[model samples]
Target: MPRHYVMCPPRHFAVDYAINPWMDPTVPVDPERAMRQWTELRDTYRRLGHQVEEVEPQPGLPDMVFAANSGTVVEGRVLGAKFATRERAAEAEHFRRWFLEHGFQDVTMPQETNEAEGDFAWTGRLLLAGTGFRTDPRAHAEAQEILGVPVISLRLVDPRYYHLDTALFVLSEADDEQPAQIAYYPDAFSPGSQRVLRRLFPDAVLADAADAECFGLNAVSDGRHVILPVEATALAEKVAARGYEPVFVDISELRKAGGGPKCCTMEIRK
Candidate 1:
């Protein structure tokens, strides 16, 4: 397994909020809380024997686009992501420099509409792409062409959720003998999109729409490791039965801006 995942510390809403006006000023901005949450998140992964490397954050970018800060790692190559918004354009530069310093090669940048790293989802040979939020549809098509993988494009219905990760995550089996189980927010996808997903993975477990809104049905990592909000205990029980140990993190501050465990992480090179 490739080591090291990149993460940036939130600046306590001190940066310019022009990129995301939806951020409520009424929410108390506490750097200490932000630091504690970041540390807890990083430490959780570290406890699992993974190195958590911290990345320097750009001065004025929106925190919601943290998922777009870098591309991804594939067989030792670090692909750079092109940011769609002007606020995020500088992030790709940092991504390139970080990969080079770390001795990773084959850095390829997507050519279309500025790529958003979060748009790229790896499921075996199928690279599903979620478009219409920050990621453009054109980039999705180009990525499939370049990567030589079938790109399943899922349309984003809610801007608050932003990336597909906010609403969906794949929970693959630990061994080849077991079937792959996908956890996704049914409400997040359109009617046709839901049908497509069901056809693709007929055994996919449908996360309740209400639970999904609670960020309970998001990404569940490891065989028994799942990161979710503290409020999702009932949902946690359902997943626990599937052998997943739900790791609850208090994301109340982060949720004010509409994000949770899945939103905060970029599973690059996993």
Candidate 2:
């Protein structure tokens, strides 16, 4: 199992601002329901024998609960995030401070519009970063130099799959011995980027329109087990056929703010 850290904010995790297409401030989310759903996801990780850590949420930062965006952790060094929009700018400092106070001393903040793990994903071999949304492509070069690994930049054409985690799922963590696996939605990428994905990950599980629309690609995996949205039937069936146990969870409440399992769970790889 891959160890991950998650956050559970005390305040209502609602879509109070329109950052992505998934957010609709007009519709209010239930605090009790969101907390219950977040707990279920966290509990699922523990039940599967994986270590789950929590980052205490600061009041008024509703989007802080999506821990994956806080930053990308690789080789025990953290390249902290610098969110693209002002709405999430305050999150960078909070996440950096938490990591530092918890013994992560190598945290460095890049002066670029990067939302970290939300737009940058580790695929065992290298890092795949999503651009044209929250992250800037210029930061990709800096990330490659800092990560000491290849960083492939993929452009997202669709606004719904604004983050890389939403369009792609990296099945195995960097520590796993087995070859890495991936799944993605072709429509989420630009024509050139889509071709790159086809040539690179030809065997990746392809999500249908319905499943992609429901955020099926936002699932998280620990090589053998995958935790995904309960509504992603088509993708779940395909994942099961591929020998992965897909644990379906109801995160509809969090979906209101445009996130799912992978968004909340940030795997630490060293």
Judging by lDDT against the true structure, name the best candidate.
Answer: 2
lDDT string, candidate 2, 1-270, tens digits: 457665655354767798899899889788789888889998998999888878878777889889889888888888888888788788889888888888887788997778888988888887899998889999898888877889889999888889988988987645556556788988999999989888877778888889888889999888889899999999999989999999999989999989898888877775
Q: What TM-score quantifies how close candidate 1 is to the native fold? A: 0.86
What ranges in model 1 sit over 4 Å off? Answer: 1-4, 11-15, 18-22, 62-69, 114-117, 173-176, 217-220
Instruction: Please give the lDDT score for candidate 2.
Output: 0.85
Report model 2's TM-score to 2 decimal places: 0.96
TM-scores, one per candidate? 0.86, 0.96
Model 2 ranges off by over 4 Å: 173-178
Highest-scoring model, TM-score: 2
Candidate 1, RMSD to the unseen true structure: 2.8
